[model samples]
Target: MTKDEVRAKWAVAKRMVEITEDEYASHNVEAQAIKFVKTKLQIAIYYLSQLDEHGSSYTMPFTGKQMKEALKTPITKQNVKDAADWCHQCRLIRDKACATWNYEEAKTA
Candidate 1:
């Protein structure tokens, strides 16, 4: 997705966080989790915003040999499916967390 698309999605997530925070008591476990997530999202948003303002250029930590070896690895259909499954699982977990926290916006997320 484009940066604009990502930003739009982030806006929705931010709003959901705000709503969740307002609904739950601060001492509640779900509220605490949301608070933690909000902090993490804020950090990520800040980092990405900085990257947008500046250039996204950065040096890779991997050595040339390590990079070459990684590149040489053939990505199979199963590998791709596994990667997608992992991402889906992560989203499912997030959705479940949101649902457990009683965040209505979780449905749309």
Candidate 2:
């Protein structure tokens, strides 16, 4: 995805809070905090993922519970893995569009 798309996703993800007064407010705060860190995380990973032509082994910081809370996905190990994997894919695509093709044009070959 483009940087703007990633940013928009992050914003939308942030606003998708399912918290209520009757529900666990502490859980809500913790989940939101995790989301904040994850957002910061995507920006960093996106910058670095571009450094590689393919991708990198970027581990997500959030635990299974946190990942489930933020993504609203199943609490499987692969689900958490896919979250990071998807970010890496976006990063590689974003970087290659700018870095790889332009460098090839400038190459001696």
Candidate 3:
């Protein structure tokens, strides 16, 4: 996913929750959702980092993988894929091109 796409998705998601620039400044409900998305993306990126550290060919049990391991329930590839897709849908990550965080564009009015 590209960065721009992620930002776009975030914009849409924020709108869906009726979050505006003013609310974000005040740290209101919409801001909370933004925070959730940011945290989720951060965790996903950390998971990707762990995968990189472990090497691409290495396949640990889903239960052993740091990201999956942290989950209370079993984490499947489909689960990660779904979350990743959600991030893309929320414009949190780009589905194509480069991945980036469009904080300025997404947060600004």
Best by TM-score: 1
Off by over 4 Å in 2: 1-10, 17-70, 100-109
| lDDT digits (tens) for residues 30-108 of candidate 3 | 4554444445545444333333332323232222243333332343454455445544443322222122324453243
Error of 1 at 107 (Å): 40
Prediction RMSDs, each to the true structure: 17.8, 9.9, 13.1
> Which portions of model 1 miss their true places by more than 4 Å?
1-13, 19-25, 57-109
Question: Over all chains combined, what TM-score does candidate 1 have?
Answer: 0.36
Can you write out model 2's per-residue Cα lDDT over 1-109, one digit (the tens) per residue?
4445545644544444333344334455545444444564455344443433323333433444654454553234454455555555555555555554456632411
Q: Among all windows of ten consecutive residues in candidate 3, which has the lowest summed lDDT?
A: 92-101
Clashes of 3: 11
Query: How many Å off is the CA of 48 in candidate 3?
Result: 0.7
Each model's C-alpha lDDT?
0.40, 0.46, 0.39
Ranking 2 against 3 by TM-score, winner:
2
Ranking by TM-score: 1, 2, 3
> Which candidate ranks first by lDDT, i.e. highest?
2
